[model samples]
Target: MQGPAVFIDLTLEDQAQELRKYFKSLGAEISQEKSTKGIEDDLHKIIGVCDVCFKDGDPNEIDAILNSIVSIMVSIPLDRGENIILAFCEKLTKAPDIPLARVCLQSLWRLFNNLEPSSPLRYHVYYHLVQVAKQSGQVGDVFYGVDQLKSQFAQCPPSSEQMQKLYRVLHDVLKDTNSELSSKVMIELLGTYTDANASVAREDAMKCIVTALADPNTFLLDPLLSLKPVRFLEGELIHDLLSVFVSEKLPAYMKFYKEHKEFVNSQIGLNHEQNMKKMRLLTFMQLAESNPEMTFEQLQAELQISENEVEPFIIEVLKTKLVRARLDQANRKVHISSTMHRTFGIPQWQQLRDLLGEWKTNLNTVQDGMVKVAQAQVELTRKQKAAY
Candidate 1:
């Protein structure tokens, strides 16, 4: 009853002070073994107060109090610690703050390690630990995070929710571009991709890699290539990216595009020839942008293809709808109307620069012509005045 008034009538600072005093008194009673037995009867009341203070306390203050609580819980007998851990876990799940949740997970991890390996309550504790760890971005946090998840994954009857949770954790850990992904997690994902019994796990790992590559901000090679398993799949991975045209679109990926493209043609699948022609068509589209109207011979010369292949290839490119082009067989010329959105490279950048430069020069010329016309009219007016 008095708790509600203390929170409403007092400032946060005063409330903190009052709550600290109350917790100190409560904690002291826990250490007195004689009084501690009866303290169990008041555990609910003690937990309710701690929860409100934790929810309302300043971050630094909350951290300090949390440390104190963990220490106190550990110092108490195992039976008491179990109840305290359960209470804190319940409170945290209702409204989890990532940073505070991390502290709670650390405390929970300590308590969990003390329990028997076959304890039924361990699963409940492990589930919440994984949930908290999934939001962690650092490599160090991933060890416990992965451990808890892996244990749950190997349960007698595997759960789809656990599998989904595992994938979510992988995505978050790998996608944290700013943090260095721990080598353990990398190896785990690679092993899963190569040998998981369930196709979903393998597919999820592959999808995560594809996603990391698609992020323009992520430089995939430097960090990912460090792992030997991932290193061995370098060519395969690059080809996968190339198949999706990401290699051609992102300038960052272009550094390896040519080498990858050559490998695709020389050693990849039987559709190599068809794929090569499609790549040539993409290059031709870039060339056509700068020369909107070109004769079949000029197009052939620019593309390094014979004149006969030009019209047939142009027809193939038209079918893809990547470019809007018309073949004028009667006049031996091709006319391009527009191109679909394509990744810009150095060549495209140069083309845009040349176009802008020409426009600037044309604008200057128009300005000069206007100036001359203005001077001529002013001089004619002066001459008429002189004649008058």
Candidate 2:
């Protein structure tokens, strides 16, 4: 099951000849042990004496050869063919043509599908797939690869070290593009270590909280608060900091920072200005929920910002789509139409119930009106018929 040694300077014909020779020898070895003579014959026919590999052979000839190799790999026992197939697929991933590399990667996925769900080899193949996909710079491919790895990790829990490596890879891929999904994966990763290593779990949980706080698009902090790792930090400074972000406003965050300047600077490692920007956004969300129309002065007082900073701050919050509002510069007022809640709990549930009840009552009133109108029409029709 030795893979062919393809030299860089070899011509396409030479490369095809080397590959065909290697597959023939390997197929002979496999045919002696198993009844794969038909598959080996098909491999030779598909490759066929490298006659397709002329000085100006079609580039697709290489693709056809690779696909044929994949077919043979699928036909053979995984224990016999896995390493050889993986080596060939791994080498093809570095091919200059991206589409060719993608085809090979897809071939690997097909091989992966043939593996048992609990096979340790699945992790290795999936890791290689993710790296190749990352190198290709295709976000969709990266997502698909990561999602596959995540599924495997769930089915068979990995070591804490392995989980940490996965967390880093997932964080790097998704931190900027998708904060919500990143947070969710981070939480699940942390959950794996809660019983095994509490300290590591707490550290990773704090990291997740800091990441979520730093992300402007990540508005919901209540979910992070429930993580087991977060509970480990219950009496710690970072935990209190998390609480501030969840339910408190700008003044509370500023006061916390002022009280624990050293901890905030050294341990948290977040830019103070950026933190204030986020806090202002959250404070605006609270204000928007409570008040439909807030004057510039009211906003400045609550957000602890200057009058000049009010509009820009509001504009930044507007960009998050967390609140829907119109600015009245002349009237110095922000007229809020709607706002997203930071957390949904019993109070939010009650509000929803009340809203539903109101809608139901309104629907009942409309139904009664419709019934009375129908009765009146029927009575008028009957009176007209009797008079006639």
Candidate 3:
């Protein structure tokens, strides 16, 4: 099983068939969500059949199976239905060594090419497939499909309203370095994720994609640089992308852990890690534009606002909708909205002192006027008496 060509030795085909049967039995137990545990050991039982299939043994059979899988993957989305794609994805984990499993993936590959705005199954398949792809590190498949969907034609073409779900799915998943496809293809596809005409949704999607593409960890840096998608948007969006990317410990921070673990720890060390928490609070205040439904601890983690500082800020922000707290829980914290503007008004004590100063100045002026009036009155009285 070298390249896309899957080869089996003469002795192994029978066991492969029986193993396929066994895998189908396990299909009921498969879950679509990502798991922390490795799928390798779990898949070992299934792949072991391929081992039995090889006249040469497990290593050769496994190579053949992986090759078959890789080959079928490229073309499956063009022809398969959503149900079948799912069935195949579940089957792959249980039956990776079998031809039937490869066939399921193959059908799935073909089906992707058939997706369009008019296709009844387009969105359903797109949504499910993107998530499956993400979990399995098959982003290249979805990326290629999306690339083909974005019509660059001048004439009216299929709309990407269907793509909304796909983008949403991607937004939830952390972009893994291992899953990168052609960066050029990814950028081209992402261009359609946000239709600038849709306003809020468009803005959000654009912002997400911009952040994703600008992310230093995303595998397609050269592709992003080559396409320059971020520049096409307004500077603010690009800045946001940069800011978020940097705030996530920067792409180079991994290297820093190796080279400067002490330094990184020292930075977080001050105030016994409270400094980072305060930074998060500031971010919540400044960067979060949507509903900031944050817990007190989350607020603490995000805003680094001290317990003392939080109460005052919470009291102040309560006037706005951004802050909320439970009366019984003193740990309650404010959820900052992204749109809130900072107003650094004069200090309350300073205002009080200025008011007192003005009052004293006015009192002195009134006193001087009263004394003058009194002196005039006395002179008039004295003159009248003399005339008499």
Local distance difference test, each candidate: 0.53, 0.68, 0.43
**Tens digits of per-residue lDDT for model 2, 1-388:** 1123222454333443455564455442222222245444433443333222322334566545554455455545556544554465456556455554555466456656655676656665665665556555554554544465567656565666766776666766676667666776676677666554666676678778878877767778888777777888898888899899999999899999999988877778777888888888888888788899999999888988898998998888888889999999999999999999988879989999999999999999999999999999999999999999
Q: Which ten residues in a row have the lowest lDDT in candidate 3?
A: 219-228
TM-score for each predicted model, relative to the true structure: 0.34, 0.71, 0.28
> Candidate 1 vs candidate 2: which has greater TM-score?
2
Q: What order do you get sorting by TM-score, best first?
A: 2, 1, 3
Candidate 1 per-residue lDDT, tens place, 37-154, comes to 3434334334445655445556566655554444444333445445656776676545346666665555556645544555545555555655556544333453444565566435
Which pairs of residues clash in candidate 2, taking residues 3 or more apart in a chain or in different chains? none
Error of 2 at 297 (Å): 0.6
Model 1 residue 308 CA deviation (Å) reads 32
How many angstroms is residue 12 displaced in model 2 relative to the true structure, after the best TM-score fit? Answer: 22
lDDT, candidate 3, 274-377, per-residue tens: 32333333354444434455566655545545666755655544444443433225546444433332222355357668979999999999999999999999
Task: Report the number of the highest-TM-score candidate.
Answer: 2
TM-score of candidate 2 against the unseen true structure: 0.71
Instruction: Supply the global lDDT for candidate 1.
Output: 0.53
Instruction: Count backbone overlaps in model 2.
Output: 0
RMSD of 3: 24.1
lDDT of 3 at 302: 50
- Alpha-carbon runs more than 4 Å astray in model 1: 1-49, 58-61, 76-87, 93-170, 173-176, 179-187, 190-196, 215-388
Q: List residue ranges in candidate 2 displaced over 4 A.
A: 1-72, 79-110, 113-123, 144-168, 176-180, 191-200, 261-266
